[model samples]
Every structure is written in C-alpha cells, then in structure tokens.
Target chain A: MALADARAICPDLATRPADLVREATTLAALRRWAGRYSPMVARDGPDGLMADITGVAHLFGGEAELRADLHARLARAGMAAQSAVAGTFGGAHALARHGGGIIPDGALADRLGPLPVAALRIDHDTAEALGRLGLRRIGDLIPRARAPLARRFGPGLVGRLDQALGYRPEPVAPEAEPPHFGVRLSLPDPVGLQSDVMAGLARLLERLCEKLGRHHAGARRLRLELDRVDHAGVQVEIGLAGAMRDPARIAALFEKGVEEVDAGFGIEAMRLVATVTEPLAPAQIGPARAAPQDGMDDLITRLGNRLGFETIQRLAPAESLIPERSFQVLAAAWSRAAPADRPGGPPRPVMIFPPEPVMAAPGHPPARFRWRRMALTTLRATGPERIAPEWWLDDPAWRSGLRDYWRIETREGPRLWLFHTPQAPAWSAQGVFA
Target chain B: MRCERAGSGALQLAPTRVHEAEGFGRHAFALFQSVCHDGPVVWVGPAHAPERLLLAGLPQGVGERLHIVRAGGVDLLWAVEEALRAAPVGLVVAELETALSLTAGRRLQLAAEAGGTTGLVLIRQGAGSNAAQTRWHCAPRPGAGADSTLHQWSLIKNKRGTLGDWTLHWDGTSAAFHLVAETGERRGPAPPPL
Candidate 1:
C-alpha cells in the first residue's frame, strides 16, 4: 500500500525507498555463499534461493536435515529464510513460498494440491480468471481435461502445473564466478624510493601480462595498491585509451601516477590488478606498419593521461538542419576519426554560445539591441533563413517555435547570428561569426 | 624553418617556427589552413575561451584532420608545447586571451623546430614582445562589396624579410587568398567589383 493511503488509516507509517539494484547484489552474494550446500544453487526469485541437491543430499545425511541446516545457518546470521526440497525445482520453489517442507519422492502432486492456484506461478490475472471458474486450488486443475483448459487458460497455465508436478523438467543453472587477474609482491625490508616501488610494479606487471596473454585479453584499466608501513594504504588507478599488454608500454603510462604514492615510513607490499579488460588477439609487428600512425596514437594517449581523455575532441559535421545539431564533437580517445564529407548548408558561425535573451527594438532585423552589456546598432543585415524545429523531438530550446535567423554586422565590429521567433515573438543572440 | 611562397606571393607561413597573429577577425586562420595542406593540425585553447571554429564553415576535409584541446590556464601553454612537439602534427594553433612571455614563446618555437611543425599563436588582446619569427595585424576592411570578401593583412614584424601590408580577396569555395593590391588606410566607399 502507498504510504499516504496507509498513513490516513493509521496516523504514523514508516517507509523507505526500495533499491532494487542493492537487493539484487545482496541476493547474488548470497547465491555465491550457498555454494557450500550444493554446487548447483541458483536464485529462485526476488526473495528466495533454489538449490539442486541431487547427489549432495547424502552429505548432509538427508534432504530434511540439509534444509534444516541451511535455514538454521541463515537464521543464525540474522536472516529469516524458508527452505523446501523436492524432486523438481518448480515443486521446491512453490513449496518454499506457499507451503514449505520436504516433499517425498513421487508425491509432488499430493503435496502441491492444497496450495492456491497462484502457487502454480501463473500471473495474478490468470489465477483470478481460474478462481472465477471454481478452480481455486491446484487440486482443482489436476483432474480437468487438458485440451479445453489449455485452449482457455493458455499454455503457460498448464506448463507451470506440469513443472510443479515433476511432469516437466525445470533445471537449476548455477551462476559462475569470474576469474580475478591480480598479482601481489611482499618485501622483507620496506622500500621508500619511487624506483623501488616501480621495480615492484614491473615484476607484478610481468606476471599479470602473462596471465592476460594466456586468456587472449588486454587490460583497459589497472589499479596499483601500495601498503605503507605507518600510513594508510594508497591506491593509484590508470585508465588506458586502448587495451594494452606490453610491460614496457604499461610502465610508461604509469610514470605520472608513480609519484603520487606517499611512502609514509616505507612500503611493505604492493599489489597490481587489472580491473577492466577486453579481448585482444595478438598481432604480428612488421617493419611495413611500424612507422605509419603509432606516433599519433602515442601522442593522444600521453596527452589524455595528463588532461582528461574527453577534453581532446574532434568535430564532425552531422546531418541536421538545427545549427547546434549540425555538428558533433567526439572524444578522440574512443571514436575513430570520422571521414570528412561535403556538407550542404548555409554558412554557420565560428563560435556558438547557448542562446541568451537580447533586448531589441520592434523592427524586421532589429536595428538596435543590447546584448552582454553592450548596446549595438546594426550596420548591415542579410537573412531571414527560416528553420523549423523537428516536431518529432522534444527540445526545450525550440519550445518557442520556428526561428528566422539573420547574420547582422554590428557597428562594434563583431558579426552576430541573431534569431527571432515569430510564434512567441522574442529575439535571442545565439552565436558570433568570427 | 622553411618558408613556402604562396601562389600570389602575398602571405606565407613558415613551418617549424612560431608566428603571432593579433585580433580575432583577421585572415590568419584563413591563410594558415590554406598553406599547410598536409599533416594534422592541433588547436589548443583555454577552457574559458568562448570562441570555437565552425566545422561546417571550414573548407572540405579540414575539420577531419583538426584536433581541439581545451586546457586550464596553467596547462594551456603546456598543452600547446606538447602538441607542437608531435611529429605527426603539421601545425599547432594556440588561442590566447592572456599574455605570452618571451621565454614561453621561445620554448614553443624550439618544440616546433624539434618536431618539424609550425606554431601559430593567436593573441586577441595583449601581443607583448615575443621570440616569434613574425607578427601580423589583420582586420576586415570596412567597405568591401556585399558579395566579395576582403581583409587587410599587415606584416608588422618579420625577422627574415621586409614588412609590408596588402589587401587580399578570399575565394570561399576554393579556400584561396589572392593579393588584390598594396593599399594605404582609406575607408569610404566599397571597393570596385572584382
């Protein structure tokens, strides 16, 4: 129920916003921890877990004992959990939510009969429709003719019934853990110099690169952790423009970050981990391709490391009538250079500012106007290029309606691109034609 | 630095040296893009500068080879020098609203020489004494014909040759500059039809 509706019935109601992402993360962590019970454990739904304890039940003595142990352990950990074991995953899932317990072998049908038809896992609408026809319990649908029920209620209604009764297979597929790529080094005596730390990093990189090479993957981001003797540990992260594996190249990229590590007394240990990686197949280096464009890539990477990668950009003309939408500024680090194409359009301004309102007289081209604290008089004007907004797109800037643009040369010496919207009848100084 | 003569022998920019151009309405960019036809150009500007090149207004294929870098006040010169030292780059255009010192100018010039790249320093306000090879003062002529574009270019400082001023007509489609004639300051009626 909504908090507002509930609070009217009972004056004070406590509520908190739901975080689905955090709940899913917690469930996934629990699924990993449940690996000790059975290797084939999978998340059943939002609030439950399902495990295929096929041959592993003997290890815990019996199915009932295993379920009790699992439930007790979760309760000890401050989590209230209900568990049910059965021959089929659907049977166990239904029992866990509705009537949880151990279902004896070949007795799935008898045990699931007392539960409501909603326990069959059909949607609420289908269950409500079935209830109106006097089939309110799972037992009511068991004896019905398959053909007519299938036609009226659809295949999903019958499919969920068969799966719960062990008449169809519902296998539990477990989630696999990803392999971690990290290497650590410990020194007997603490080292303080930056060179010593770099030496340690080099050794770690050699090991990490070898692992990456075996997997045919390359590192896109790396983290180096320095464990200082007296102070808290320091972590330096390196972001790469492209996936790289070479130790020499990776070390060169780390040159700027190495100085940021402060070894309070001395650094006892260092660890390097490849946090983000991408598949990169080995390519043969030949003399023919060595001198071509490596210098440009190296320059981009070097500059991107100092300044941010996004600040370095290349502009490409886009196909749009809107002046601002006619060009795109792409990051040089990620996007390949776009080929130059001859664009068909009128001359655009060299510099464009976000549209700012201007005070203008009531005239065709606005003979007099005040903009950016300067009073200006138009000496020459040329245009009424009418450009309509794209109706399909909702743009706040174009809310006022169609615009008629003009290139007005001011007596103050700067040519301005001004626009007058007829629908709302307002003037805005958009850009300067320098 | 090697100076290549233009077809009209009017305005030429040398590769591997710093040339300072004053004013924003000048033909320095028009002349630079016309001369350096090969290698990539890197444009470095301060993060606060409001002006930017209109790619649609530039000639065909020039926007593809151009790279723009925006840096803060302190890193502005550093970014310029770094771009000047890249061999794959043909030219570096540094747009400055602040002043450039003689030492900083010499350092940028040396980097350009080492990388065999040209550097154009565009100063909008203060054009202090610098170690650049040439200093230019250009402005759009007032009474040019409505159709034809004209700009007055003054080569105020030249380390290797004599200084002179000329009136140049710009062909928009061809992206070429033709020398019209040497002129003294006379502002009245529009120039005669081409």
Candidate 2:
C-alpha cells in the first residue's frame, strides 16, 4: 500500500525508532570534527552540536564564512546540518529549527512569535494544556501575568520561554582534548624506495624533534604511518626508553622497527608521530667536558627494545608481610624507583621462591632440606618469628595454622629461608629469601 | 704516653693546612665541580629486563650519565614531558595498546619543536589510530646463504623520505643494519592462489 493510503487508514503513526547508541556515536564524531572550527565544541543533544565561536568567528573572515565552511564540510561528509548564530544557545537552537535564517539574535521573540507551541520543546501534555487555555502562540502567552501563568503551567514552561528569549544563562561544556603527536609529509608522485622512505622519515624526525626540543619534551610512544596507493595504509609504532627529542636517535629507533612492513603494491605517503610525550630537563656539562662511557639509561633503552618492555622487570615494595609477597615485579616503563629498605630490618635473601613442603617435625629445624634435587644440612637455626593469619578474611590456608618463621644458617652459608609450622606439630619449608 | 696523647689531641683540634697548601680541598673542589655540571640521564623504559639489557649494552662512558626512572600505567605524552624535564638528551620509548589524544599529540609536537633533543616511541602494529610522522612496521625474516648468519627486515613506513619496500640484511651479533637485495616480493611467503 502507498504511504499516503496507509497513513490515511491509520490516524496515529510513529515513524522514529529509539536507537540511542547509534545516535550518540554519530554525535560524538560530529563533535570531534567540529573542533576544527572551534576548540570549544559540545554535544547539545543526541543530534546536535554547539560550538562557541564568539571571538573565533573572525578567524574565518566572518560569521557567514564560518557558517558556510561548516555547511560545506558537512555536505562533503554527507550530513544535513542547520546552524544559527545567537547570543544564547536556546535562542540559536529555536531559531535554527523554527526561523531558519530570517531571525537575528535580538529579535528572537518577534521571529519565534508565529511558530507553533510545539517549537518550545514542551511535553505533549503541556502543549495540550496550553491549547485548552486558548494560548496558541508564544506571543499570545507573553501578555499573561507571570505568577498566574506559572501557577497554571508549572515553572518549567516559564523557564523554557525565558531561555528561548535569551533571558536565562546557558553554558557549553567543551569536549576533552585527545593525545597525539604527529608530523606530515607531502610527497611528489609518491616514491616507493626504502632509502627514500628513510630519508623522508629522517626529515620528519628532524622536524618532530625540533618541536619536542623547543618544549623540553620527548616522546615515550611513537607511531609511523604509510598512506598506500590503494587508499589504505600501514602503521608501525615503538615505545621509548624515556622521552627523547633527538631526530637521529628517534630515526635510529625506527630503523629497527621499519623492518616489518610488507608494502603490498606500494605506499604513496608517510607520516610520523609521537603518541606519548614527557618533559626533559637540560643536560649538565662536566668540568673536564669528557663524555662518559655507555650511560645507564642508554643501556636500558637498548635492552628494553630487544627484550620487550614488559619483560624488563623491577622490584617494588608490596604491602604483604609474606616473604613471597613482599616485592612485586613491575614493568620499567611504568614503575618508579624501588622503595628503600626498611630501617633495622633483618637481612633479606638474594632470591626467593614460593613455599616448598618438607618432611619435618614441629619446634625443630630440619637437619637436612631437599630443594630442586639438592639437600642442604642446617648447622644453625633462629627462633620462629610468629605470624598470625589475618582472621578478618576467610582464607583456607589461614585455617591450616599459625606460622613460626625461622632463619636457618646452613653449613655452606647463611641462606635466608623460611620454615612454617601450619599445625602445632608439623613444620614445612615455605620460601627462599632474596 | 701523656705527651703523645696531648700531641694527637692538638692535631685533631687544629684546622688542616694541607688543603690550603694544595690550592683547594679535593672534596670541596669536587663538590663544586659536580654542582656546576649537569646531572645524569634517567633511563625510562616499559619494563626492567629490556631496560637493564639496554643499559648494559651502552658504551661505558654513557653509563655514568644515566639514572633509571621506571614508569607504570603512564600515557605516552606524559612520558614525553617527563623526559623533557629529566634529561638533557632525554629519550622515552613506550609500548602502547591505544592511541594518544589529539591534544596530547599536539603538545608533544610543540614540545619536540622546543627541545633540540629526540623522542622515540614504539607501538604495536595496527593497534591504534594513525597520528605519527614516520611509521615503520618491522618483522623478522629468514637469513641468506649457507651459514644462516644474517636476518632480513622490511621497511614499511619511512616518512623521512625513505620510500618503497626495501630489505635490510641484519647481522644479529653486530646489531647493525645492511642494505639487502629487494626481491620485489612481499615480506612473507606468498599465499596460495584461490
């Protein structure tokens, strides 16, 4: 059946589906793109974006030029957009939808007077209430006493009307800034030589490092992209030892990373960027002015790049009292320096592993302990530092018993190891000390 | 014994004249020189193993110039800022699972311009959005010749004017890159035809 015939047969019809997620995503992308024109862009609703272009309007030659630019860009992107410039967000919104381009900012009421009551964005019940009271137009309702009108229609109606006429304040919340570092390269005819690619990268790196150096900054994270001839592209990135701004150094780092690309067909464009950055302090010069040998940081960077940043580990203080849980292994790129040892603490072992069960009796140190197929005789033993389980938490192991830890000195040397008595009569080897 | 004890006490109470005779005290002069000179480099990396290995590999002369600053859960831009503030020739490299914000990226761009040093960032292949100048995707390849001594690498993106797909025959032991013949074929073995 034709839509006209179907509509004629059905008096009430609702055509819109409530798909909020898709609408929200589209709005977010729109808001992000709108940032090109104004840094202060906000999502007004599910389908609208508001840009604070007050002083920025002049940058595009005028308000008209800005509007035209926006329209053109939206058109290119295949979106239908309507815009209005007003002193207030409500007036602009109402005018954009009701007055189109005819109404100016100061004449919002005059321009909006003729529009239907529904343009005020009131609920259906409110509109019906207004209709029953014979108040069909905004101008018609303005002459009524404020107290009486508010009493009859509630404060929301008055507030909406006031906002539409620019009587109330409106604020625009800007979007959060994104993190990125980039350098663009325009090529002539899109060369495809590896040497040429590296040369371009070197130039870009120089430009990037110059910018970073000026700000006393370096990049911890870097990304490289190749816009290929097929309209597709490939990206490669690397993490840094620390933030750095030297083009030669950065380029050298990429020299190792660029070996992964399979330039299907050929790439026509390239770009380099640092996704993460950090501040770098000025370097101090020595009195003798002799450059030192391999710096600790440089060695770390080489090792980090080769072994993978995650595999590089460091010890950090843990809250646990258990020997196995006293220190944690953390990634170097992400962790700070290790915490200092506690004052007047017992000496710790060079290495520590999880607890190992041993055949032993309570209150007595094992004459011999077998670990990893090796047996060691205990020549001396220290008293057990009793540690009670935290009763607050329902731990199954805690129910086993309280532990009495002992530092046993073996015949070979002093090995910091732990032996715990789970029950009153049984003892087991628990861990090695580091 | 009393005379000897009195002489030792006098020596302890008296100011040392040897420092004046030597022009300046060695400790004080050393302290002054250190105060006047720039501090060491802070090595920041993703983790400890690679960081330690890299530190170990550095020339001994450069090793003394370093102070290691290990970071955790830090974004790339902040890392760059830390590098800029901490070291004169500060270098930061990070492995990230996501892309940096546009504002952060722009800030880094400005920071790089301000500092005369260098920043190198590493990311996983095809992980985040495109926002870099020169991006190169690297992968390990088979070695050439009977000895199997060299490994090959492919250059994916060289925004520094290094274009096209080229091969690098690398000597792992030497940790250096050497130009190799380009097969003109893709890096991996060709896929079977449909």
Taken in order, the candidates have interface RMSDs of 2.6, 17.4
What's the distance in Å from true for residue A162, model 1? 4.6
- Candidate 1, residue A126: the lDDT equals 99
Compare the candidates by lDDT and give the number of the best one: 1
lDDT of 2 by residue, A154-182 (tens): 99888888877777877777766553468
Best by TM-score: 1
B-chain TM-scores per prediction: 0.83, 0.53
Report DockQ per prediction, comma-separated.
Answer: 0.42, 0.02
Provide fnat values for all models in the order shown. 0.55, 0.00
Q: Give the worst 10-residue stretch by lDDT in candidate 2 chain A.
A: A289-298
Question: For model 1, what is the alpha-carbon lDDT of residue B135?
Answer: 81
Worst 10 residues of 1 chain A by lDDT: A288-297
Q: Write the per-residue lDDT of candidate 1 for residues A315-422, one digit (tens) a residue.
A: 987878887888888888677777766565566666677788999987888999999888888878879899999999999989999999998877665577899999
Candidate 1 - CAPRI tier? acceptable
